[model samples]
Target chain A: MLIKYSVKTALTGLITNKSRSILTILGIVIAIAAIVLIVSIGQGAKDLILQQIQGLGSKTIVVIPGREPEGPSDFVNVFLDSLKEKDYKLLKNKNNVPGAEDIMPLVISSVKLSYFDETYQATILGGGDDEINNLMARIFDIFPDRGSFFTPQDVSSRASVIVIGDNVREELFGESINPLGEKIKINGRNFRVIGILPSKGQVSFFNFDDMVLAPYTTAQQYILGRKYFDRIIVVAKSEKVIARTVSDIEITLRSSHGITDPDKDDFFVETQADLVERVGFITNILTLFLVTIAAISLLVGGIGIMNIMLVSVTERTKEIGLRKAVGATNKDILRQFLLESVLLTAIGGIVGIALGVALSFVVSLILTYSLGLNWEFTFPLSAAALGLGVSAAVGLVFGIYPARQAAKKTPIDALRYE
Target chain B: MHLIEVKDLEKTYYIDSVQTPALRGVSFKIKEGEFVAIVGPSGSGKSTLLHVLGFLDRHTAGEYHFDGKTINDYSEEEIARVRNKEMGFIFQTFNLLPRTTVLENVKLPLLYSGVKESLWEKKARQVIDSVGLSHRLHHESSQLSGGEIQRVAIARALVNNPRIIFADEPTGNLDSKSGKVIMELIQKLNNDGHTVILITHETYTAKHAERLIRLSDGAIKEDAPVDHRLVAADHFTK
Candidate 1:
């Protein structure tokens, strides 16, 4: 028979039994939709983790105190013994090393701050005049205008000053007025508010927007009555230079602390990429976990397609016989059934991709409005391609046996069938 | 020239190894432009003979020839090709493909013969109109009356302009008036120099054929030209 006739006949045959065709396409739709939705969720999660990692800090290295040996734990206080106040001073003052641009000292102290109606017990960071320079690279992230961090001169004057987190501003001043130059008590002592940050949120175990900043000199003189600054931060020239700078800092700290063995070192130096990769790894594991579950739904959907195609083959057995009797080649019969499957899956794949994109957009919209954080709906093209490819392959893989059975039927027996 | 020759054709149907011979030593020959009808009661192997003649089913043991060449050694595909090229079939049930238009069904034989669709279209329409189905060209087989459906089958059979058209009870399901129209159409095609072979149990239908052959127990018991009385009766009844 002519191919056009085969196509026309098969197409109208589907239309003649519209309900069955719709149900068959629905099976393919569900498979494609599951694939697309799973991949979208996976991509969305990666974006979320990347955003969170960026929120932590850009190109700034974290130097956590490394773990100490178990035996000396009771007496050693190794966190205190390995590095000291002079280490922070050295990093702050030094400039000869390559890949190292600037370092700043951070002194953390838990203090209670009270605004007229509300009080918050927040971690206070006290540092030096260079402390303002220390934050220059980090603060550039918020990318604001009209206000910046306090000046170095303001810090060197031993000024009792402050910079507030975004939430802290809301808690203390409401939305009506700027809190700059207002006085808030830190442990019952008043400090001048120099600048309010640009609402940057929590980062790597600390909420910068919710806390306070003061001059290290004044913090020692009036608050802690101590001169030793706690943690030292080093900002590299750029991300490409961070690894070498971290190693340089490692060597500098080891020599400064008189540590001979690398494993026995008391501090850990890591770049922003290291942090991103760690978080990315966790999210990747989560994506795999979620997609595996989604695969089950796709598998069931594929089986449903196979089942329906089998039923169709059974229904069309006599038709197949008739065509074969009329001089249709076996290949012709195979193409007919295979084309039916491909058409069903292709339609389903398109509809599923559209629905998945719409669903993800709705989810992101809800998150932005309700959670107050923008979670972008990311529909990656690869996800859509995967949906289409997987569904079509499923159709072919599952549509074969029944098609063969139909082709193998003899015309004599088929015609004899009532 | 003889178009078809058959001798000692045998077909055995196996019902769990209990062989029932459907054809036993059946023999016949058809000349060019011959219009012959084979009539026999049920179980007399007339349908089996048609199937064998059409290359639809293989005979268990037989010598069958077409155009002076023995077809027993022809491959199944070659037989099918010959069937497609040299002969056409009409079923008792007017075996037009359901869900297809009159045009599509009529174009079927030419499609199998690989005639270009443009030629198939023109010729199919001409044949369909010749069979008096031009008004129903686009109608599906299900929409057709029994007589109309048979004409559609005849149109399909004649589309290829085959050497012979083999019909099995072409008008059995039609009313007497419609049966007469169908028989008259077949007779007209045969008179126009197209060979035709019909397998039917009705003597009334058999009268339309110039030659009548009777089969009993898978063999031809009698073969002769129709007597004048039967021909007159056939003409007067219609």
Candidate 2:
């Protein structure tokens, strides 16, 4: 019976001071909304990173030369031709890396391709002839739309033949013209187009639809002449042995490069699983940092609640006296005020969650429309639950001082108060 | 046995290092179902004595007994329990909750009385009707007149069926007409077998009670029975 009375009284108290209650609850609302938004956006970024890594195919391992680029300045390390041809040969030997099924080396450069009078700037990719065909078609899912890729004999002979992407074909030869078996000029030299590639849109923020592919030996020997590979993609025999293959490639490359110190190795090897784990770790830290900053606001919100409750206690002194005179115990008065503050924060928390969900939808829409990013909308259930739990804890923690002050008022003094 | 017994009751007030005695060595007792008045000028400690009697304040020195049991050693919790079950208070200001309806104000005590939920509103309505404010059951205390507010307070004091009602200047804030009506109501309650201890400075209000105890300088000056004017006038017509 007392509990029922207390609840009714608490509700009446809130209604009696509507504007003050709303302002106090608004503090909690902003704090909880910030928490939900941070966690949701963090989860979205993690998903995007994982999706990018997955697009590389789980069975593939990547090798980069010149010490793994750890920071923005280290990106220049891609220009260092530390991984020589001998290192690639040693890694491809079955006895050295038994877990490897196939290896494909890649070299990329920007060049102008011309078909008769029209010309367009395009990224030129150089890879082994048949290896490029099988790797692009099977692993990357890129296949020629109208014609077949060149043969291994073409790569051995350093043939001046090229396969053009969908956008490159359209740009140089126009959509009406079939570019297969047409002759294109590369570095002012005549080169024949052997195939046309279907568009693969964009993967990992790079557009594969605006590039041309040629035999690695042909590009290395003739156009923008270079003898070193930029990056290598290795297909593991199976998922179970991917880790073993990573270590084996590291040892074989280090030995071929004549490196004795592990730390001084010129190349870095990474599997798809390792990339996924690294992305997840970075995103988790970002989430934690954002949440910690938001929690400071929650602390201030709790303090605001306490300030309002203290004013309420002072305003209701006469009522407290009356209640005490009519047989209400100190415990009853304490419980009444505590219930009111908890109700305030709990309701604030629920409203914050709804607002956060709506905000996340707007964020995802902006990402998709303006930036053309495939952003996913997520409402993590644990975040909502945590928001509610934290709000309740804040209410209890901040409400106690004011509530105890109310309970401590003696009936005679309270009744005498103006 | 006396319904109330007091032996040299004393209460002292301390402000900073100063000791001010509000009540000094007052003694009195009353039988069951009696209507008694404690009258005095302001600062004569009549209100202080009433508060101590109602268990709203503690006595600095005293031995008090109610219904043959000593209450001098009762803890604050024990006193609160006894007040809930046995004591009711009617304040001079008609201290009904300003935001609540008349019925809700009257039912406040029953919320602590352990009454069944189904009977709370019923009992509250019955007492409100007896006080003749049944028509204003749903009206907030702020919306009520002074007379109606005091009547609601009386109904609240009666809702728990307390053994004794401590009314500290119950009509001090009302007009003379309303004050007379409140005095008559208290007389009727006493006649209906309810113990009432009224505290006031007005002699005319005390005249309605069967007995009077006058205080001066924190001590009782006179303790005697008076010819109750209302009861006497009714007797003469009969």
Candidate 3:
């Protein structure tokens, strides 16, 4: 019965005072829209970052040497301090682990190159033939381009043959040069380009499409004199071998380095899947922060609704009195006013949802076409329900007080009200 | 038994620091089926007395009986229930709900009484038609003329089939002809065995009542009954 009267009264009020009711509801609409839009954008950013992290490939792992702040450094540091070329001999032959079909150490350094009077600068990476083999499947997954990789003999003999990325060729050769077999000078040493690599996009601060690769022996023996490898890349045989393979690799590498403490181990082991989960975690934190701020703004909107409803009650005091005189009870008065509030909130929620979806859609489209990213638009039902439900709850909580006050008004005083 | 009886009723009004007395030791009685008019000048407390008699306002101190039950012990809800069940009220301004249609205004009491939904429209229409407002039953209060609006208020008052129809200056806003028409309508209702209690300042209006009670300075000044046999039925013929 309250709903009926409320629907009728609200409908009449909406019709009678079109501009005022719309203006009042506009505040709630904007607040809800801002809430949904901010959360959606935050969620979109999180999802995008997570997707990029996953695109690094989940089967791969990275190891970083633990930093020494309070305790003594690992044997790798001592080896670097003593300057011995024999440490490489200890690590070279230990290949038969449970999961590792191959493991290769890399030489990474920045090199400035001049090609046919054109200078292009890039990071130069060097590793064994097995290093190239490990990346073959990953490159095919993302790029699937044309070129043969390095071989065991080419790396073992310390061949001067080099592989250049597509962007480096474009930047240095420019317009008329396909320098697949051209010799490029790095630190005054000449190396012939063997194969032009396909574009592999970019990760973090480095452009994968602008790097140069050579035999690890060539880099250590000719370009840089340091014997210790800069990094190591590995590939497990299959998904089933991952867990056993990782432990076997860790144990083998630990004994080879003469380290017993896992915390004080020189190298760190991380997988691409771990990186993806970290990205997801960070996105959730960011979304949580953004939603907290939006909720505060929604609180202000609720206050606005409460204030307006109070004013409406005061302005309609005489009407209330008249109704009471005609035999309307307190409950009837409360129901009518409360219904108006719910209607206002529900309508605002719908408009806000539309705005949020539209804005997020536009951003996703721009990201996909203009920025050329694999930006995915993820819409979860939980997020939508949270947005719609909060708006309605705000309505009920803020609206009930004024409704109660309106209901409690005495018929005598209300009738006499001006 | 008297339809309404009040004795030594006192009412006080406090605006701020000063206490203004409106009804002091007022006493009056209206028998069943009596058409009584309580008259006074502006500020004479006649309206206040009528309000107390209608249960719309409570006296600060009073001994009042409706039919036979003492009203002092009733709670606000109980009083309102009694008002809904026994008394019908009409104000000078025709206090019909402004935003509602004439039909809805008349049906207001039935809604309050929790009457069956099916009988609401039937009873509302019956009373509205009986008040000769059948043509304007659906018109909004704001859209009705002064006389039409008073008729709507009367229809509302009769809709619940109350024991007494209370009118406080019911025709004060209407023209003399319309006021006379309204008074005659009240007389017809009173003759049909419903008690009618009117509070008015117009002497001409009071002449239409069978009994007159004059109030002065918050108390009853006179209680008298005038014989309508000596009064000419037609004004032009008299």
Candidate 4:
């Protein structure tokens, strides 16, 4: 028989029991939909994080005060205070690191700030004088919406002037009150708020809206009461020189800390590109895991298809006999049943792709509008293609036994079947 | 050569290693363009004889030749092709596919034949018109009467222009009046030079054909020409 008639016959067979066909394909629909949703959302998250990491500028590199962690147990080494003021001063010298544009040492700690009657717990970020502070602002792309950052004189005098984030201002001083020049108590010491940052939610793993910035000298002398630095931020002169600058900073830190062996180095440097690669790897792994979980449902769906096809073959025994008597070969019968199943799963795949995309778009909308994250709606075309292929494969894998059973029937026996 | 020749054809049914014979040492020959009826009561093995002749089942021991080729001479695929191109069937139950249009049902044989798709509708319509059912082309089988359903089956059998048609009690499911109409249609087809094989238990129905082979106890008891064969054109006014 020609393939066209076989397809038409298969279509007629499916259409005769429209409700049963729909119910049989539901498992395939749900499985494909779940796979598409997971892959799309995972792509969206990866894009958002990569975009934020890139926003930190390609020339910017972070020098964390710990060795590169090789395992879970080594994670504790990240919190060790290995970077100090002398290492910072050595990295500042042009003779020591020629490609370094600016170096800023950061000391971060969570602290409570108080006004007359209000108290708000916020992250405290302490950094160097004006030039280094400006570099930090340039990297974060954030500046004061009200007052200005502290000057060089504040670092030299250890003056207790501070820059408060937008959330701190809202908590201690309501919208009606100007928080600039207000004396906020930190660690039982009075500090004048010189700047109020604009409300920026999350950027490069930090929520700038819930932070307070001050000169590093004041934070170390009075608030934190520690002499070691937490992190050192380095800005390379250009993207082309970032690799050379990373090695330069590594060598400088090692020399200053008297570390000759490369493996014994106490500091680790990460460029923007490295962060993007790591984030992409993690998201891909997570998406693959979820897709694997969704494939289980597809297996179940294939079994459902097999079950329904067996029932259909048995129910149409008389029809099969009639067709054979009219000269349809066993191969023709097999092709007809196989085509019916493949058509069923292909339709399910199409509906699933549409449903998954719509659901992902709705979720992205909620994430963007309600939660204020930069979430983009991504359509995973490769995943859609993979879904379609897998669904068809499922049909073939599960449909063979029933189709063979149908083709194996003798015309006389089938006609005599009740 | 005879169109069909059978010698010592035997069929045995094995149920759990217990052998019960269905066709025992049957011999017959049918020429081209001849209308023959095989008559027998229930359990007389006439149905089994029809099944073996129609290639719907295999005989255990036989020398059966159809169109100059033995049953074993053709492969499975070639047998299906021969059936599609040279033979047609009409069941006692009028096995028209349910929920399908009359036109589609009539076109069923042509689907498996070597006929071109562009000519299927034209051939189907011509046969349906021969059975006087052109007006009900698009009606589904469920909407058809028993007689009309049998006519559609007849149309399907003729659609591929086969050399022989096997009608297994074609009018068995219809009323006497409808049965007369179907018999008239089958007589007209045989008169038009298509070979017809009719299976029936009634002697009156057997007399409609030119020749009769009476079967009893899995073997042929009589083979003779009908003296007073019914001429459907003279009996029924159109």
Give the number of the best model, judged by DockQ.
4
In model 2, pairs of residues that clash are: none
lDDT of 4 at A388: 93
- Kindly report which residue stretches of model 2 are placed more than 4 angstroms away from their true locations once superposed: A1-4, A68-80, A93-95, A110-122, A128-133, A144-154, A163-186, A190-201, A254-261, B1-3, B66-72, B232-238
Which of candidates 1 and 2 reaches a greater lDDT? 2
Output the lDDT of residue A188, model 3: 85
At residue A202, candidate 3 shows an lDDT of 59
Top lDDT prediction, candidate number: 4
Give, for candidate 1 chain A, the lowest lDDT window spanning 10 residues: A137-146
Per-residue lDDT tens digits for candidate 1, residues A297-406, read 76776777778778887877777765655566667777778767666667778888888777777777887789776477877589888888877777787778777877
Query: What's the TM-score of chain B for every model shown?
Result: 0.93, 0.94, 0.93, 0.97
For residues B1-238, write the lDDT of model 3, one tens digit per residue: 7778899998898998689999899887788889888898888898888777877677888798888877787776676666677888888888777678999888878766767778999999998887778888778988888988998889888887888988889889999888877887787788778899989888888887889988889888899995551232332111
Please report, in order, the local distance difference test score of every candidate based on alpha carbons.
Answer: 0.74, 0.85, 0.73, 0.89
Question: Which model, 2 or 4, shows the larger lDDT?
Answer: 4
Q: What TM-score would each prediction reach against the true structure?
A: 0.84, 0.89, 0.82, 0.94
| The 10-residue segment with the lowest total lDDT in model 1 chain B | B229-238
Candidate 3 chain A: worst-modelled 10 consecutive residues by lDDT: A78-87
Place model 3 in a CAPRI quality band.
acceptable
Better of 2 and 3 by DockQ: 2
Give model 4's docking category.
Answer: medium
lDDT of 3 at A226: 69
CA lDDT, candidate 3, residue B56? 67
